[model samples]
Target: MSFIGIKKNITQKDTAEKYIGDVSTYISNNYSNNIKVHDIAKYVNITGAYLFRLFKEYLHTSPQQFLINFRMEKACELLKDCNFTTGQLARSIGYRDVLLFSKIFKKSFGISPSDYRKQL
Candidate 1:
């Protein structure tokens, strides 16, 4: 068989799993920055459409949702410490608008940042 055919012998499921892992790692490492699906797709040597489809199929989440969830989780962790203001915390977690961050935070945890900190 030719090289192309040989390479094609690899299962699509395996390739999708590997790509999803790579994208997950990329999101984990860069969650503090504004990352887009196209950027991740480029990093993994795939097209944006393919990346989206793979993420949806394997992770049941879009890349953007994954990033937002990651950021919110990080924000919750940081909220335990009282060093940063809400704005600073939001910015640190890749949110430029504190109000928007608060909205997302409230939606994710069902409480405001200040209240969450108070509980800690």
Candidate 2:
């Protein structure tokens, strides 16, 4: 490729990386809120479909999956150190329904959050 073509490729790669980083940072900063894929796309100035593609290409996961994983990871950290009830823990991690949160926790870690805490 020509120098100009190489430069363009680098710039495109950089922009793609920046968008992914922006999405990740936004999720990390707002995982405690009831945020959605559309909200995240808006924050990053992209369409939701594009956001999905970006995450799928770069992270090998859907954006929604990434968000869920992020929330679950954060929940694990909080559960380790905080004396939060299940409901409180759910809300703290952006889950309004304790049952749903528990379900996801069980799916992710093969145990309920309470059980996970008990083990901890």
Candidate 3:
């Protein structure tokens, strides 16, 4: 490839990386709120479909999956500290339904939230 083509490729890659970072940061900062792929795409100034493709290309995961994993990881940290009830944790992590939160948590960590807390 020509130097100009190489430069364009590098710039595009950088932009893609920035978009991924922006999306990840937004999710981390707003995980307590109801976030959608559309919302994230808007925040990053891209269409939802494009954002999905970018995530798949760069992170090998869907946006929704990334959000789920992020929330679950946060839940694990909060559980370790023992600062909140399951319901509170659920709500704080953007899950209005405690049961749903528990289900996802168990699926991710191989233990219920209460059981995980107990182990901690």
Candidate 4:
């Protein structure tokens, strides 16, 4: 009785789950770039639909929402520096348009970036 086949099956399952971490690392490293779900899926060699389902199953959110959360968190960290202008902060987190960044930031934290910085 050999257990090698069972171990191989477990290894394959682990490899499948590895894609989630891979996608997260890719997002973290390149969150500054204008990356889309498709880009992330391509990195994991999966379809965008599969990536979405994977995220939903594992992380309880879609990739797009996860990206938004990541960007907003980065914005919070950058907001700690009072010297950074809104436009600069926006660009740092892959948002080219300051207004859109402000909108999303406000939506996420219920405060404008400037006001958030002021609180800090």
Q: Is candidate 2 or candidate 4 better by lDDT?
A: 2
TM-score: the better of candidates 3 and 4: 3
Tens-digit lDDT track of model 1 for 20-106: 889889988887786777788999999988888987888898877887898988998898764799999998987888999999999
Candidate 2 runs further than 4 Å off: none
Candidates ranked, most accurate by lDDT first: 2, 3, 4, 1
Model 3 stretches astray by more than 4 angstroms: none
Look at candidate 1 and tell me the lDDT of residue 40: 87
lDDT value, candidate 2, whole model = 0.93
Worst lDDT 10-window in candidate 1: 4-13
| TM-score computed on alpha carbons, candidate 3 | 0.94
lDDT of 2 by residue, 1-120 (tens): 999999998998898899999998999899999999999999999999998988888789999999999999999999999998989989999999899999999999999998899898
> Which of the predicted structures, 1 or 2, would earn the higher TM-score when compared with the native?
2
| Location of the lowest summed lDDT over 10 successive residues in candidate 4 | 8-17
Model 1 segments more than 4 A misplaced: 1-10
Across residues 1-120, which tens digit of lDDT does each residue of candidate 4 receive?
Answer: 259988997786686579889998999999998888899999989999988887887788999999999999999988885478999889989989899999999999999998998888
